[model samples]
Target: MTAPFDDLRDESQQLDSLVAALTPEQWAAPTPAPRWTVAHQIAHLAWTDRAALLAMGDPEAFAAEVAKALAAPESFVDDGADEGAAQEPAALLARWRDGREELQEALRAAAASKAKFPWYGPPMSAASMATGRLMETWAHGEDVAEALGVERPPTGRLRHVARIGVRARDFAFAAHGLPAPDAEFRVELVGPGGELWAYGSEGAGQRVTGPALDFCLLVTQRAHRDDLAVRADGPDADRWLDIAQAFAGPPGRGRPPKGPRPGPAA
Candidate 1:
């Protein structure tokens, strides 16, 4: 079994590499996400990583705390108080880097001591937390890559993304106010490191297959599945292609340009 620390370390290194090469002007460039500058995207990431660190430190207690925090108005000034309010993007970036380091430390410490972490909903093992971070960083990294007009570098971290894609099916069903699909589907990906990331049978149908990174990008709505080389077989699989939500919170309507979805695979 691969260690959680390895995943977390790789993600941090990837993030650092990206940040290091960015010009100050590039940092301020507008991304595909409407009205969100690259700076804004990173700020959101920094905030999220910090939040994850806090939650990991106190999983059980933080579960209730997260509920209350979510209830409160989301404002740096209000939620983080004066010190956080004063920090600008550069400061936020510095703090974000720090948070990454802190999370690595937390993961290492947790592994040695057997610490548990709180997640958005369910309890997360320290290993899961690392995967969750890997998933988030890579997805968000796509946005950054888009802003810079660069193709994303491939990585083995995609396994985490595949898992998130499967989980998003639940979000998709819930968003449309429909009961969960009656069948499960297997998901396979063809990428730098092709693998059977996930397989479902019976309940939600069977078999979802394609490029690993493409599958992840498409499901997260970062890229259209049609735009990528991903292919999904089975009934529910086609339906899943219509909508997939990975992140938590309320469902996003996603991009405009409504048009006919491609017909089912032959």
Candidate 2:
């Protein structure tokens, strides 16, 4: 069986390859993320990758860093991105590549351990940590791809992202200080290869069904629920779509419906 880290590595390599060919002007292009350029997206990834490495190598040091971040949760992420964005494009790319390699090595080395790594939210096992990394990589990569006017091909790998989105339904509500729904919702996504990936009970009253790519975009806040092909069958599921955040953080104000989605590349 392939470990989540294997998928993480593949996602990282795909994003790296995509960015490596970008021109300097393209790197500076504004992404879908408000106030964040392509550089900021990559820089943020690099910063988190370094933090993940620290968490793996030295828990005490990582805890200290986490404490500092907790002191200013709102600004910590942006501040780190600003620092990373100051680097020249080459330097930034190198830093991200090195950090990613280090993180992968650490995860592999710790595969046998049952230790939980502390994060902004709950601590995570190595497998969950890797899945989170994969989700982040794909989410941010969408921003960069959009800035370049490149259409990212949807893949079966999006199963990881959809799973996270389903799992985060309650987290999304809780992050906004709202009470979580009492019942779980079934999530059914059609993979790029036409496979059905279903989660939760088939008979659940609340359910979300959609194309995998649209679900991913919605969960990542790259596209508004209104713009996606997804459908929520119940009130709770509908509310979840209004604020479905896969990444750990405050509740995100999802993208507003900005005209119809563009057609696929001819």
> Of the candidates shown, which would achieve the greatest TM-score relative to the real structure?
2
Could you list the CA RMSD of all candidates, in the order they appear? 5.2, 2.5
Question: Which residue pairs in candidate 1 collide?
Answer: 182-203, 183-203, 183-204, 183-205, 184-203, 184-204, 184-205, 186-200, 186-207, 186-208
lDDT tens digits, residues 1-266, model 1?
Answer: 34667876787677667766676788778877766666666666666777787787665666665777567624431344234424565776787788888877877677655556666655677777777777777777888777888876788777776777787687677876867776666776775755455556544446677778778777667776567777767666677777776766555546554356689999
List TM-scores for all candidates, in order: 0.80, 0.94
lDDT of 2 at 4: 87
lDDT of each: 0.69, 0.87
Tens-place lDDT per residue, model 2, 151-259, is 9898777888888888888889999899999998888999999989999998899989999999999998989877789999999899888888998877665787988
10 residues in a row with least lDDT, candidate 2: 252-261
